[model samples]
Structure formats: C-alpha cells, structure tokens
Target chain A: MSETPTLESLQAALDAQQAIFEMHQSMNMEVFYWWCTAIMFLIHAGFLAYEMGASRSKNALAAGIKNILALVVIIPTFYLFGWWIYNAFPGGFIPAEASAALPWSQSMGPDAKDLGTGVFWAAFALFGATTGSILSGAVIERIRVSAFLILTIVLGSGVWILGGAWGWHPDGWLLTKLGYHDVGASGVVHAIAGFFTLGVLLNLGARKGKFIDGVAQTISPHSLPMTLIGLMLIIVGFFGFLGGCIIFNGGDTGWTTIYGNPTNLSAFAFNTLMGFSGGIIGCYVATRDPFWTMSGGLVGIISVAAGLDLYDPGLAFIIATCMGVAAVYFAKLLENLGIDDAVGAVAVHGFTGVVAVILVGVFAAGTPNVNGLPPISFMGQLTSAGVMIALGFLPGYGLSLLLKKLNMLRVPEKCEELGIDEVEILAKPYPEAGVPAIAASDVPNKLANTELQGA
Target chain B: MGTSITTWENVSAYFTFADNPMALGLFVAGATVIVVGLIRSIIKHENEAFKQHK
Candidate 1:
C-alpha cells in the first residue's frame, strides 16, 4: 500500500525532469549542426567537379585545386573574423553585443560551459566558403591561383559574412526595420556572390578568342557528361544547404525561420521539389541545350527561395518555371553586353536572385513578420536587393581592379595559351587520350608535342 | 509534509548517472554536445521544419 504524494514532492520531480529535458535538447542541437557542416562539403565537391569539367582539359586540375584550397583556407580566416562579423553587425555597421562570438572567447572553442558556439562557427565557415566557390567558378581558367585565393578570402571570409549579418541574422536591420524576408537567402548568398563574380569578370575579361567582331563564340566543354553529373551532385548538396536555414526549437517553440516566423518542414518539401521540376521544364522549353536545362533547376529553386516558407506549392512551381526561362534570357543579355560569365553565374545567380526577392515581395506582401510591426512588402525587398547588389559588386570590382593594376589578377598570356595546367599542375588529365597534350596537359613532358591520330 | 509525485505512469527509470556524480557530469557533457549539434542544424538550414503535434 502506498501513500498519496504531496504537492511539494510533485514539484521537485517535475523540476528534475525539466533539467533533463533541457540537457537533452541542447545535446541534440549540437549534433544536428555537426552533420549540417559535414554535408555542406558536398557542395564544394560538386562545384569542383562542375568547374573542372567546364574548363578545357589543361585547366581542369588547377580549377579543382583552387576549389580545394578555398575549402581549406576559409576555415581559419572565418574563425578569426568572419563569424565575428555575423555576431557583431546584426544592428548595422556598428558592432552589437556579441562577446561570445569573439575569436578568443572560450565559447568560440571547445568549452564545457557552452555547446552551440563551435558547431555554429564551423557551419557558418562552410557557408562563407560557398560564396568563394561561386566566385571561383566564374573566373577559372584565367585567374592566378594566388590572386584567386586572396579574393576568396575577402569574399568568403570578409564580404559575404557582412551580408549575412545585415540580412540573414535574426536581429538584422533588414528584418527589424524594413520587413525584409529572405528565408532562403536568395539575396544574401546567391545575389551577392553573383554580383561579386560580375565585378570580377569586368576586370578579368573574356577568355582569349572568345569574341570575334563583337560577337561571342562557343567554347565547348571537354566532358559535357561530367559537367552535367557534377550539376546533379550540386542539386543533392542543396538539400543539406537548405536544411541549415531554420532553427530547431524542440519544446514549446517547435521550429521557426531565421527571422523567427512560423514555418514547418512541409513547406520546404513541397516548394524545393516542385521548384526544381518547374525549373527543369522551363529551361528545357526555353533552350534545347542540356547544360542550360540543368542550370534552370538551380535557377528555379533560387527564384522561389525568398518565399519558401509561405508559398503554396503550385505558386512556387510556377514562379520557378518563369525564372528558369528568364535565366537563359539574362545570360544571353549579359553575353550580348560583352560580359563573359563562364557558367552563367550572373544570370542564374545574380539576376534571378534580384528577381526572386521582388517576386516574393509581390506575392508575399502583408505577410506577418516577427512581432507584426513590419510585414513583407515590395519596397522593402527591392531595397534589400539593392543592398545585396552593392555589397557584392563594389568589393568584388574594387579588389579585382586593384589586383589587375598590380598585375596580380590574370595569368601570363603565354601560360594561358599553353594551358594553366601545363604551367601550374604536374599531372596529365587524359594521359592516354593522345589528343595533343599541348592543348590540355598539366606538364610539358612527352604529351606536349604529341598530336591526335585516326582512331 | 509533501508526498512524492512518483505516480505509476510518470516515474522514469533511473539511469546510472543519477547515482554516480562522475557519470552525471559525463551525461551533462554529452547532452551539451548533442544540443549544440541540433542548434547548428536548426539555424543553418533553409529548413523544412516539423511542428510537433501538441
């Protein structure tokens, strides 16, 4: 026979349970971020493959190395300053209260008192590295490795992090005052990188013999299949990149957007997939070329990214489809204007990113924001798009111009004529193909003098 | 005097950590790591969130 419990004893038991629950919640949070960082690496792998395949055989190895270096070099630099910018500037240029985010802070490293900080930094570092990779692809085959690394450091670790702080953070001015809502970072990540690449291209100029009599010439990929496969891998990596955008508040809070708006996983599932299909269809209908079709899938997702949290599935699909078509037109427009973006980075990322923000503003206007004082509106989104453009383009153009003036931006004309790999890398990409190493090999060995023969 | 809230349905089975101080510390440490991991996941994703059915 047992006696009835008193109220005080019940309270004691409940408190203990609450403590255990908090502990469990915190631990779950750490592990989730760790995996998010790990999966983000796949994005770099895909970019490496994609860029290398897009390049002439001689430049492939160098492209891969540049991507790898970006992945490795960003970790420390981001730790030193990039993560701090995210923590510091949510209020604007003036630093906010973020002692915990300081590089020397115990919480910034492995510390028993805090669990979330290190993983957060690592994941953010990956995000920063991604911005570098975007700029990396556009300038490949012509850029000096040293100059490229410096630009990568500035963009990946310096510039993009500022955009993130101002636009992506919870306490960001873009959100609190302007009612800016970019749940999927269409403006911050994609647009900023795209514009930055545009700036670099202005300085870097078109690849040699790419234009004759003010008309563009086609430069075919050595392995179209490899480029397409790499694009598919990038699509797979996007699943993880998208996963890192929301907060996993477990108990009373459930989940919320980075801006602290109501959301659920269902919205992501419907939109991301539908958007991909719509983009592919739109691209295929617009251009019969397989390469542009794959790019359309990426364009579609970005087009809908700004409103991913609230869009009806059908609307997302339709918006993505339109953007997919627009991406091709945008690319052609840039080409006509004499801008040589190697992978259509400007149209697919920069132009579509600007359009995506505007689309969401029109479609998602009057949508409630956190605290409801500000609501999503066209003007606010347009302003944010402008900011993203300036943030990306100004720094990109200025730094690249400086590099050019110093003669540190492009490789020597002779080296470029022979292939970057032959000047920089030592391995032969297609050793047995016998297709003439002078055009594509990494080394000036036996293959350099050899020529193709009848099959 | 207060009676225990140890109802038949509510009482949890004890883990060894509750009895050993060192083990309890380890439990908290492990929990910290896990929570940190989850926070990293939640914040980085352009996520699809699941609202637990209350």
Candidate 2:
C-alpha cells in the first residue's frame, strides 16, 4: 500500500511549479524586447538620410560617412563599458553605496533565467548613437574626421551616458538627491548632444565662406526630399523609444504602478501630433521658410518630449510652439556669436531640452514621484537642468579646446578650399555614367572640336 | 525533469504537418536569400565608392 502525500508537501510542489512558469513567461517577454529594439534601430537610418540631405552637395558623403562611423565606434565602446557606467555611477554626485554593474555580470548575457539586461543595454546604446549623430550635422562641412571621431566617443559613449546615470536613472543622484525627472531624455540625450556640439563648434570655428564681413551667410541643403524622409523616420522611431522606456515586469498589472504611470500611448500620440502641428505653424510664422518650418516640428517634439508623458495635450502644444519660436531666435543668436551650427542642432536639441526640463516643473507640479518622493517642483527641475548643461558643456568645451591646441580639430585650409569630398573622402557621391572622360591636356582638343562643330 | 516526451510532443504538434518539414525548410531558404540580397546591395554600394576613389 502507498501512503498519500501530505497537504503541506502538495502546496510546496505547487508553489515551485508556479515559480517556474512565471520564469518562462518573463523569458518570452525578453525575446519580444529584442524584436522591439530592432525596430528602434531604424531611427539611425533616418538620422543618416536626414543629415546627408541637409548637407551641401560637396559635403554630403563626408557628413553621411562621419555619422555612420560615429555609430561604429559608439556601439562597441558602449557595450564594453557605457551601460555599466550608467548603473554604477548613478550615485556619483551624492555619496551613495556604489553598485557593481560590470560587463561580466550574469544578467548581462544570455540566460534562460534572467532576461532584462540585454535589451535595456541596447536601448541605451541607441540613445548614445543618436547623441553622436546629432553633433554630426552642426560641424559638417569643416570638422576633421579624426577629431569628430574622438568627440563622438566622448559624447556618445561617455558624456551622454553619464548624464543618464545622473538624471534619467531611477537611482541617479540627481533623482535621489534633487528629485530630477527626465522621462524621455530631453536633458540626457538632446541637451548633452547639443551642448557637446556647441563646445566643439567653439574650437573648430566656422566653415569657409560661412561668414561674410561679420555676418552669417545661409547655406542651402543639397536635397530637400531626403531631409523630409529622414525627419519622418525620426518621428516614427521616437514613438518606440518613448514606449520602450515604460516596460516593467511585476505581476497581474499590465504596464502599471511599479514604473510611474504618467501617461499612455494615446497620451503620447495626442501630444506628439499637437506639438508637431504647433511647432510647424509657429516656425513658419517666424521664419517663413520651409526648412525651419520642418525643423520646427522636430524642435517642438524635443521641447515637450521630456514631459510628454505628464503634460496635457494642450500644454504640450503651447510649450512646443513657444520652443519652436524661441529656437529660431536662439539659432540667430549663436550665429551672431560666430558659432556656426550647420543644422541648428544647438537650438533644436540643446536649448529646447533645457526648456523642456524647466517646463516639466510647471506642468508636473504636485505630481508624486514613482518612488513616493516629493512632488515635482520648479526649483528641483531648474537645478537638474543647470547640472545637465554644466556637465555637458564644460567637459566638452575643455576637451575640444585641448584637441584644437594639439592641431587636430579642423582640417587644413587647402582641404577646405578643394572640398573634403575630393581631398580626403577621395570618392565622388555621383559617378558619371554617360559623360566622356577628358584629361587636362585633352580639354583644349575637346573644346576646339566643339567650336568647329558649332561653326 | 521527468525525461518525458510529453512536453516535447506537445510543442512539436503545433509545428507538425504532412508538408511542414519541406515548407519550413523552404521558408528558411527564402529568409536566407532575402538577407543575402540586402548584404549584396550594401556591398555593391561600398564597392562603387571604392571604385570611384580609385
């Protein structure tokens, strides 16, 4: 005769089975995270296209290649150390116990048991790549490839990630000590990238023929269609970016209280559209130019992106409109200061990010932190924004100045005169398929033949 | 843990069909082809850039 199992033993067995099932479910969700990550990667393609289109025909290939190379350098560097920096240095500003988030951590690699680290790391890497790319546009026509590459590593894998650790991370000192909140990286990504571009611009100086008798001259884009396509891609990628940040895996609650529930997809969608519309209209009214108008949409979203999850749609629209109008003036101000930003990146990303952070204080006032800290306040937000600007600008400017002193920041004047395309790039973006090749010696003969034919 | 085919069989049943083996193989082949095509295009672009410089 067999003895029946006790009730306590059966309950224990059931608990063990439940735990195993939950682990499997978590792993499945992690697989979906990778798929979402791939979608977000499309943003880089958009950035590449948009930046290339905005550059002059002579500089298009150089600009495109530069942005692409930034990604190449940034990805490996980020994988090796950047993600760990974010996790480890969150308490750097305030003296909290340091946590080890080394690359060799078990959660970082493929494991059937733990599942969140890889995708989370990837998401931050994409942010780093974007930070590097935004600076590409500002110094396009003149920056030395080597200098820019160095800057890319510092800003992309170094500075921006540091900002994330300080402000955007849950355990970041800015958050823990100052009650800092940057939901979608207005301060961490856009502000830092913009400021870094400004720092480099101060040392690299303006492009050849950019200024005339102390006045800035406008340089038109090579292709408008390509620029438009790039902008649209960025808009689409941003949706996934903002959405991905909200992911958490606790219990029966789907996308709930563990992470702050400031807003949902619908809220973001509504605010994004309104902000874009308002920005475009405002920019058009200010500049009466299609280029600035399109840029207005971008500036608008960036301005409100920090607080989109918290702001009402109407507030987002108003704030975006104000930011767009302000950006045009700021771009003009930078130009007058002899800082030539080819794509207005400083105004669009840097200035607008600061503004967005400040606006969050107003809109999110009295809102409780996810961790039950004090409500969002204007002073707290201002202090956080100031820290972001200082951290990004001071180090970047110092590094760039040092690079300039080493004579490595800008290309030779001869290369600038001949165009970086024919000099250093050594490749023509467009190869003539039908045109006959004529050597310098043969040019006279060809001209004579054409003249004789005309006679 | 039980060294049983119960879980394995249940999972396989979802994918099992009379023509599934061939169809799955063909699908994998198609994906590979598409990926190869994209790689070819990227390589062509780079080659053209190199040729222009030369």
Candidate 3:
C-alpha cells in the first residue's frame, strides 16, 4: 500500500537524494585526482629504468641511484617552498596569496575537510621532479651524486616551479598580460627541462673517448629491452599527467584547463593517441632505427601537447610526426657540435617543446582567454618560450660552472675511466658467475685490500 | 530570492580547506620524516667515499 506523497513528503525525499548526490560527487572528484597522481609515478619509474639501460654497464648503478635520490630530496624541498612559490609568484615576482600554501597551512596537511589539495599538490610535485630527472640522464656517468642532488633540488623545486607559476597558473602574468595558452606545459615542464639539460651538458662536456680527434663515437645502451619497457611505462603515465592538466568540476558540468577555459577529457584522449602514433611512424620513416622510433613517440606527444585541448586528432597527428622527424635531425646537429646528450633529451623535449608552444600560437590564434582577455597570440607564446629558456638555461649553465670551479661537479679523470659504480657504489651490477676465488663474501675484503694498497 | 550572478565569495568557496590542529600536526610529521631520511642518505653516500679513491 503506497501512500500518495504530500508536498512536504516529496520535498523531504528530494532533499535526501540531493545530499547523497553531493557526497558522491565530492568523493569522485578526489578519486579522479588521486588516480592521476598515482599514474604519474610510472613516469619516475620509467626514468629510473630508462636511465639505467642507457648508461654503460660500468656506470649503470650510479645512473640509477642519482634518480632515486633526486626523488627523495626534491619532495621535501618542494613542500617547504615550491608549492608556496606557485601561488605566490603567479603575478610575477610578487608573493600574492602565498599564505594558503605555506608549510604550516592547515589546508596543506591531511585534513578531513579537504580531500583534493594533497593529491593535486602531489601531481604538481611529480611534474617538478620529472624536470630534474631529465637533466639526470644527460649528465650521467660523469656527475658526482651530491652535486647532482643539489642541481636537482634547484631545477625540480625552484626553477621549474617558478616557470609553472609564470606560465601555467590561472593568474600567471603570461596568461593575464600576454594571453599565453599552454594546456600541457610544453614550455613550462618539457622545454625548461630539455634546455636546462643542454646548459648542464655544456658545462659537463662529452664523456671520455666520446669524441677522439674531433670525430664522434656512438656509445650504445647496455639493454634495449629495459629501455623500451621503460618508455612504454612513460606513455602510460602521460595519460595521468594530461588528466591533471584539466580541473574536474562536480558531476557532468564538465572540466576546465588551469587557465579556466572549458575543455573535455574526450578531446585530450583523441589528440594524445593520434599524436603518439604519428610520432612513432614519423621517426621510423626518418631514421629506420628502433631507439629513434620509440623516442619519436615522446617527441610527438610533446609536439602536440600545447594544442591538445583544441586540435583535431588529425592535425595533432601531423604536427607530432613533423616534430618527431625534427627531433632526430636536431639531435644529429647537436652531436655534430660535439654535445653528448647521452639520450637525445634536448631534441626530444627542448626543441620540440619550443616548437609546439609556438605552433599553438599560430594554430590557436584568436582563441579567447579567460575573463574576457584578448585571444591567444603569437607574440605571447613566443615571449613565454623566451622566458622559459632564460629560467632553465642560465642557472643550469652558471651553477654547473660554479660547481666545476669548486671541483664538486665531475669525478676525477681516473674515477671516470674506472667506472662510477666501482668508485662509489663499491659493488658490481653483474658479477661473473664462474670465478673460483672471487666470491660474494670476498668482495668487502677485496675492496678493503685494494684501498689499503692504494693508501 | 536571489539573483544568479557569481561573485568572489562563490568562486572562492570552490577551493577547499581544513583549518585544524590535527592537520597541522600531520604536515609537521611528514616534513620531519623527509628531512631525517635525507640527512641519513647524505651521511651514507658520503661515508662510502672512504672505501675507494678511484
């Protein structure tokens, strides 16, 4: 026997349903951002494996350890000042509204009232750390761990965060005054990291025996399987990285970019996939090499990233393919100049990133910015690119030069030839299986004996 | 009873926060752990240099 609902009863029922709906929506938003942050972990894992495999057998352990340490050190520094800087300097050099992000701020901690802030901050922190890892691979085999950690902190938690504030934030000067638009941080993250690595590489110089008599020599990776697998993980992680770029509004009301413009995840999905395929195909066609073909995929995504929110999938694909071709050729140009990139990060991330941001200006001309600002323009995007180069390159080159002068940058020439792993790690990655007198137990004693002999 | 125009208050309400002592304590604890761990790592890495010169 159902009662016919009076007006009051109907109203009560509606209120209950609305409350439940609100709760569900709140939880879903938190879950979405958490998932994005979790997925971004693969980016670091990929970097670890990718760097290890790229390094020669003698320096593999050293290459891998520095990456882990970078993550360890950058997390705390980022919390201390990096998050604050993002909110503080969005207006450019002025610490406007930085209180909300201070380390002592209640909102920055684990609180029942806020479920979203920590996850969001974690995602951005991952972005900063990714910038540090990019420089890590280029200067591997020669760099001391302590010196590398110092540079990592500067780039990861300091310089890169500053770039993000000026370019990616909603109130950023680049967005407000210049009408700059970069949906996927091609300039802020990728370009800054890529060029910063170039700056450091300039100071670090080529590895020993790399360019004898002014002729370049190719140093091959120890394991292609590991490198390829690592890259695939990075591709998977990128899905999460791009997801963080869009803010989720409650329910089906849709999402917005950091710039407060309306966008949809469907558009991002289409462009990312098409761009990735185009890059691989383009690289395969140009170099016909496996490494370049795979790296082309990364270049392709970066190439199309700035325009991802607005591009037709076909257009995204075309742009990515062209960038892929350019990345391989540009890498060759750097090599000819005797710049040993070790993994072609400069061409893949830096050059393609700059080109992509500029392309967005040409392609997305007249697209309206938020708050009734003028449309996105060529000069705005170009100016942002120029700023990123200055922020990324100058400190990288200058500070690394300073480290070199202090004798804290590179290992001694003898140490470089003997392998960073043996010199620092005190262990080998792969021990010979069939050495009668050389046992695992003898390693420490052997190390001690050698040390005593040297002394 | 009200117009549908969005104001600064409405927009600011979209950002979430929790101003409580428990949350503050959690931030301090997390930070302390990271700092301690970093110090330990630096000590260990530096100590290894005594074993080999090349």
The alpha-carbon lDDT assigned to residue B50 of candidate 2 equals 37
Cα RMSD (Å) per model? 12.6, 10.6, 7.0
Candidate lDDT values, in order: 0.80, 0.75, 0.84
C-alpha lDDT (0 to 100) for residue A363 of candidate 3: 90
How do these models rank on TM-score, best leading?
A: 3, 1, 2
Q: Pick by lDDT: which candidate is best?
A: 3
lDDT of 2 by residue, B1-54 (tens): 212123443232222231234554455456445534543553454345434444
TM-score of chain A of each: 0.93, 0.89, 0.93
By DockQ, the best candidate is 3
Clashes of each: 33, 0, 0
Stretches of model 2 off by over 4 angstroms after superposition: A1-28, A93-100, A256-263, A433-455, B1-54
lDDT of 1 by residue, A158-209 (tens): 8888989988888788888888988887888889989999999999999887
Docking class of 3: incorrect
Listed in order, the DockQ scores are 0.02, 0.03, 0.15
Best by TM-score: 3
Q: What is the Cα-based lDDT of residue A30 in candidate 1?
A: 80
